[model samples]
Target chain A: MAHVSIPSYWKTLPQRYCLIGMKCKNCGTINFPAREICISCKQKSEFEPKKLSGRGKIYSYTVIAAGSAPPEFSEQEKLAGSFPVAIVELEEGLRICAQITDYEEEDLKIEAEVEAVFRKIYEEDKVIRYGLKFRPVKKRKSLP
Target chain B: MTLQKVAIIGVGQTRFGNIIDKKAEELFAEAFLEAVNDVDKGIDISEIQEVYIGNSGVGGGQLGNFSSLMTDYVGLTGASALRIENACASSGFAMRAAILAVSSGVCDVALAGGEEKMNDTPRNRVRYWLGISGDMEWERLSGMTFAGVFALMAIRHMHEYGTKREHLAMVSVKNHKNGASNPKAHLQRETTLERALASPMIAYPLTLFDCCPISDGASAVIVCKADLAKKYTDTPVYVAGHGGSTDRLSVFQRDDVTSINSSVVAAKRAYKMASVKPEDIDVAEVHDCFTIAEIIAYEDLGFCPKGKGGKLLEEGQTEIGGKIPVNPSGGLKSKGHPVGATGTGQIYEIVNQLRGSVEKKNRQVSGAEIGLTHNTGGSGGTTVVHILKR
Candidate 1:
């Protein structure tokens, strides 16, 4: 397990919970987890916080087997035999990796629509860490 | 200041596998002594002016001041020594440092090596050590292992390029076959394509055989100014070019997860410095931490066109007798990846191959004049490429 200090986790809550990214003023590139400089233009440009739509499609995914989860997620792995994790390309054009929640294996496919949802990431003895996870978007049915 | 040319006169490595009897320093000493003896005219350890040791401190044993400890254990305590850490590419960067030290006229002779005793740690704790290499904030927190990260790449390659599982299996089979001929390899037995395909799944699309074993070993190399290389050995493998680069640590952050951009950038720099194209490479030893990594390497290193790595393997172009033999020392897949030591380990193999000194005739690439090594750190975050020639 990796040690995530309380202060560090607290500092990142905004980006973790609200998907706050840094929009580059020079190149108009949005850097997730935010950055001081623009990644695309490599400029020391001013940046503003941008909230994402929390919607995206799967770019890639993998089913991590039980017991193979990092020491931090051992508890969750025990409850879930095998779970899918994916890299989602958001509608805003930035990418983030997160676990896919509330889905079957068949639902985990490339380009499958998903939306971020608040969920518990992991728990230590003293505190619980909550963040966003992606799940398949429910399809709407047509009415007569 | 004008930079001097550099050459590797000698190289050595311990047989990579579980060996509980020896400590990490002891293994490093063994490799160092072998390297000293490998020098054709013989070398005096006291003549070494500097040393750079690579280690990830996986077991937390001697994490601090590790390079000094390794030098002290080997009886070269007074040399300028430091540890270089870059996850799996630790020693690869160490070698680069040594090359710079000698080429810049900072030292006449320098030693570059790496060591790791991975098997000593408990299995669960080992996971913690490895997990920290990736993005702990997102990837690890989301329950991603090193294998899981590569598996994701494997699946994406399959989806985009129509790479079959068999292409991945072929890499394992070929490396195992080469390793069987190498006495020092960790896994020295070959398996059928059927057996490789049937291996239990560690992560979806990545089976047990797709992964390299946790290994314990050390490797060392002796480098000197090219002008003085003749004093140490008659057949010196010149370090023609070296390059390194880094990218976003997290895989998802990159524009394309299918290929490691660091490798591509590093390889391009190396080729430019060497004044040679990819076609000039007679042989190569690439970072094959996972089967998919090797496929990506073929494309990244310019062995073939992008999205055609699997096809290149299927055509047997990378075999020993083929166009460009790769991993003749069995590679990380079968030779064993002891993390930090892996980089110099590849250097050891290439130096030997270029000198036509490989003990096993079967695994030797005949008439190999130029060789290359590609070592990556933490997926695609850091990469080092070196080109060597006789």
Candidate 2:
């Protein structure tokens, strides 16, 4: 895998942010990156962008051994030898595909709990890039 | 009831194999000529008033306009021609447009066709061509390819509906068996479920066998007013119903990859407008670009309840004798996918079923009077569903 690239905004954000979006006030549907027009209802609406809850269930996942790598992981061979990618069903109802950072590709199961965390994927120069890939959410000290 | 009707008086297709000798225009012209000639009762090319060409991979032309290059070769020039592209569903949408124009009384006769020549282009280039269909800003940026997208969908279906990995192999086994009976299919050899299951995986749960092959071919269908169909052929197929809707182009934007509601929306409209039920269709050629796609299609088209598609496979309901035969033309699976030409190609097969002219044997459903074609653009983002009747 190769050729995955990211923008400066996500790379340089002060806090780890999972890229998420909200539906327009005028239209009751959601969109990514927030747009003025609702794609479904076709209304020129505005969405209030919001950070994701960072937790979701694994909708689907795969262990892709082939295909081009994203630009951040130009050294993808080190990452690609074995990796997990999942289509996480965010609690908000939108399904998002992201890399699973904390597990082996074989460990993935359908509907497993998961959460997002910003990981410094690579550093080409002074810019240490980050991506909003996911990790299976372990139970946080239940009943504490 | 004077509901508008459109008849495909002519049809054509390039030989189903890789070719390097000619450009796309040459292929398009050749297929168009064959289609024009397929008009048995006799037709003149000059009478073709408009042209709608489907091509997703024709590149470097001064204009992205595909019809400009082929109308002259097909012996029809200066006719109002427009290109129709909806990814792999390009030709299907082209057929819908042609049907609409004739049914709307705008055109007496229309030439609808699609072609793609992609042998010489490297695999990576083909990947790039298809990559534009998904979310280029996010999914594509993450290096996800078409197979990757469908792979994701397959995984999601498994998670949500308990779709088994073996069920994916069932699709390949069925399509290959059907393909074995299709003379023009890219791979006309039957493969067992075990063989399909054991094939190398392109993406997890989806093997090389789970995917359709890249094809270099062209197809054409001539549409005319329904009343005029009797003048050309005794058994003219009617476009009983059609529905098309667009979903979010980006995979990430879709509510759920496995739950493609766009398909249900389009299919619902087509079924309602036609006053026909899914169970009434005798055969169907779904866009099985990947095996999982066909699974979702069964659910989306209302052939079965949502989440029951996998059980449909296990029960053999989609097989020829079980319930309603699906992808009997081998579908995009073994039939090969030429992107722009796939939609028309599926229609070609369905029409043959209605007309009783399928050259290959063993795969044909007995007495198939009604058929359906489902074509999509960029995952499930855009879908066009057509119901054809004899």
Interface RMSD of each: 0.9, 3.3
In terms of DockQ, the best-performing candidate is 1
lDDT of 2 at B157: 81
The lowest-lDDT stretch of 10 consecutive residues in candidate 2 chain B is B57-66
Error of model 2, residue A119, in angstroms = 4.2
- Model 2, range A1-144, lDDT digits (tens) per residue? 223344534542422355657677776666655556776677887677666687888776666555433333446636566456677777877667677877754458877888888776556556655667788776568685
Instruction: Give per-residue lDDT, candidate 1, residue B125.
Output: 84
Error of 1 at B53 (Å): 0.6
Candidate closest to the true structure, highest TM-score: 1
User: Model 2, range B112-175, lDDT digits (tens) per residue?
Assistant: 8888876767765665666676666556545466777888888778877889878999998988
The segments of candidate 1 whose C-alpha lies over 4 angstroms from its true place after superposition are A142-144
lDDT of each: 0.92, 0.78
Model 2 chain A: which ten-residue window has the lowest total lDDT?
Answer: A1-10
